[model samples]
Target: MNRNRRRGKKLSRALVTAAMLGDAGTARRLLRRGASPELPDAHGTTPLYAASVQGAADVVALLLAAGARPDTESGHGDEGTPLCAAACWGHAGTVRLLLAHGADPVLREDHGTGRAPLDWAERGPHPETALLLAAAVSSRPAAAP
Candidate 1:
């Protein structure tokens, strides 16, 4: 493996580990130490995306605050965005955090899944999440709204 590839893998592992362990402080420390927030794992899963799917709100917040791009899509799984992953997993707080951080709710996966964040929200077991997504979709500007 080349040096850059090795470095990326190390960073990816660190971020994923921090996220999975729910250690927001450690994750932030890594970021401050120059770890790349956009680093992806072997499966192309970004730390932010993983944190969102796992419902780690503090991790998500720390990643975002440290400049993790909310709109970043995982290179695996049909280019799934953090918002979509969060919504699909019923992580209401993560979804809200992503949206508030400007995650595009209408983004579609590259796999032609037709699975927008709103779609995931609709399928959620949580009523509050469903309602929030429904209202958000309904309130979208229609080019002239």
Candidate 2:
């Protein structure tokens, strides 16, 4: 099936697939046709989340530029944030990109346990990635009252 011919929810799914595969072109086309960057898969992972997890820096950038909220959480509880997903997989570039787009490192909203992005990054074996996350988190300004 031609990806361009897909419609409605199908286009949304295709967008997710494209984001997962890091196919920036197809994802761009789908987004142009109204496929939401915030659309979630059955697992509740948004296209941006998928792109972050797969280390698709370009796709992540495209999604972010398309208005995908950097703080949007997935369905896995406290581990579902786009930042957490990227950090878990040790995608340093993706993590940096998300941070640049305003992803909160301390956001532990809904990702399973209450783990923040830095927590997830620490769980991985990538010390450099963990260091980056730590720096980003520590460098964050305190929330205003």
Candidate 3:
């Protein structure tokens, strides 16, 4: 493999690790060095998804600002969208950030028996997160049947 490509791959992996660790400074530095926020880790988890799942609001914000898609799906089947991950963990702040970035609260998991972000939030018993997701869902136009 090309040297530059190899470096980029390493940087991408590092970015995902930093995101998972909630190390905003490291994540920012990696991003500045050209790490792709959308690049998936070896496990298929994107930086945004990892950050969201960990409730790393700062890292999540950085990733989103760095061009990470708020609704980007990550992880293996049934792992769901970033919004769902945030909601599942009851990360109200992260959920708010994602919603501000246009995340669809009604989006379901990619695999069988898909569940929406609201379902995840409710399952978490995260009343605040659930409310936010509910409002977002109510405000949006219904999906086409």
Candidate 4:
């Protein structure tokens, strides 16, 4: 690979690490330095997805503001969309942030074998988060018959 592509990948890895650690400051620094918020790590986990899994609302908001797609899926099998990760971990606020940023509540992960965000929340036994996702799901317009 070319030097610039390699550098971009390196920066993306650093951003993902910062996001997982919930270090919003370092994430912000990396973003300012031109790290692509949408770029995925080797595991297909984007920085936003990492922050969502960590329930780092501040970092999530930053990444969203920096143009990270709220619905970006992560990992190969177990991890699905960012919303799925947040909901699975019972990260209510993170889930809410993702919803507000247009993350589809009904998206499934793991090649369609994984559960939707609401299903993840319910399975997580996070009653409040489940309720939140349920409401979001209910509020969406139904498909045309």
Candidate 5:
């Protein structure tokens, strides 16, 4: 990788690890050091996405509030989106936070799976997650549908 790209990867890796570990301070520091919250690692997972999958609500909020795209799609597997990951993992708080930040639970799916956050939530381990996402989807104006 080029010098700038290499540095960017390091930052991205640090941010993702911090988010996964729920180290908000480290995450903030990395972000301030010019880390791109949306930058994915070799595993194709961004900080916000990793935070969501790990159920690190604080880290998810931090990344989202810092302007991370709430709908960042993972580059892996039926891939889905951040909201999808959170929902599938039963991170109700992360799902709600992302929705509050304008994430679309209905975002397009990868691999033509045509799955949305609601779809993932339906299969989630927590029933409350499905309820939370259902309410969020219902809250959006019908015009947006």
Candidate 6:
């Protein structure tokens, strides 16, 4: 593989590991040490995306605070948003964190049946997640007349 591709793979692996471990401090340190938060894994999952899916609120927050793109899509066939992954997996805290960080609830996965985060929440096994998404969507300002 080319040098850039190899480096990208390495960074992706490190970020995914840090996220899965839920070690926000370690993730932040690695990011500061030049690990790309936006690097996508072989499965097209970014570190922030993985952290969100794994319900690592602090890691999600750290990645977001570090300027991770909230709307970045997984390059995988899923093409999902971090918010969608968080919602689908019943990660309420991660969902809330992503929302507070201005994640777009309207973002739709390209490969899936084009489901939004709200749709994922609705289909989740946890009713509370659906309720939270409903409340959040309702509370958002309606477009100006």
Which candidate, 1 or 5, has the higher TM-score?
5
Indicate the residue-level lDDT of 17 in model 1: 82
Write down the RMSD of candidate 4 (Cα, Å): 1.1
Query: What is the overall TM-score of model 6 with all chains considered together?
Result: 0.85
- What range of 10 consecutive residues in model 4 has the weakest lDDT sum? 71-80
lDDT of 4 by residue, 1-145 (tens): 6999999999999999999999999999999999999999887888998999999999999999999999877876757788999998999999999999999989888766778999989988999899999999999999999
Predicted candidate 3 versus true structure: per-residue lDDT over 18-43, tens digit per residue: 99899999999999999999988778
Best by lDDT: 4
Local distance difference test scores for all models: 0.81, 0.84, 0.91, 0.92, 0.84, 0.82
Q: Name the lDDT of candidate 3.
A: 0.91
Candidate 6, position 51, lDDT: 90
- Which stretches of candidate 5 lie above 4 Å from their native place? 143-145
Q: Estimate each model's TM-score.
A: 0.86, 0.86, 0.93, 0.96, 0.88, 0.85
Q: Report the C-alpha lDDT of model 1 over 1-145, residue by residue, as the tens digit.
A: 6987787688778888888777888888888777788888787878998798889999999899878899888866655888888888788898889888888778776655668887787777666777767776777778654
The TM-score of predicted model 5 comes to: 0.88
Worst 10 residues of 3 by lDDT: 104-113
The TM-score between candidate 3 and the true structure equals 0.93
Can you write out model 5's per-residue Cα lDDT over 1-145, one digit (the tens) per residue?
5999999999999998998898989998998899998888888878988898888988988888788888778768745678888888888888888888998867756844668888887876679988988788787778743
User: Higher lDDT: candidate 2 or 3?
Assistant: 3
lDDT of model number 6: 0.82
Of 1 and 3, the candidate ranking higher by lDDT = 3
Itemize residue pairs with steric clashes in candidate 1. Answer: none
RMSD of each: 2.4, 3.9, 1.6, 1.1, 2.2, 2.5
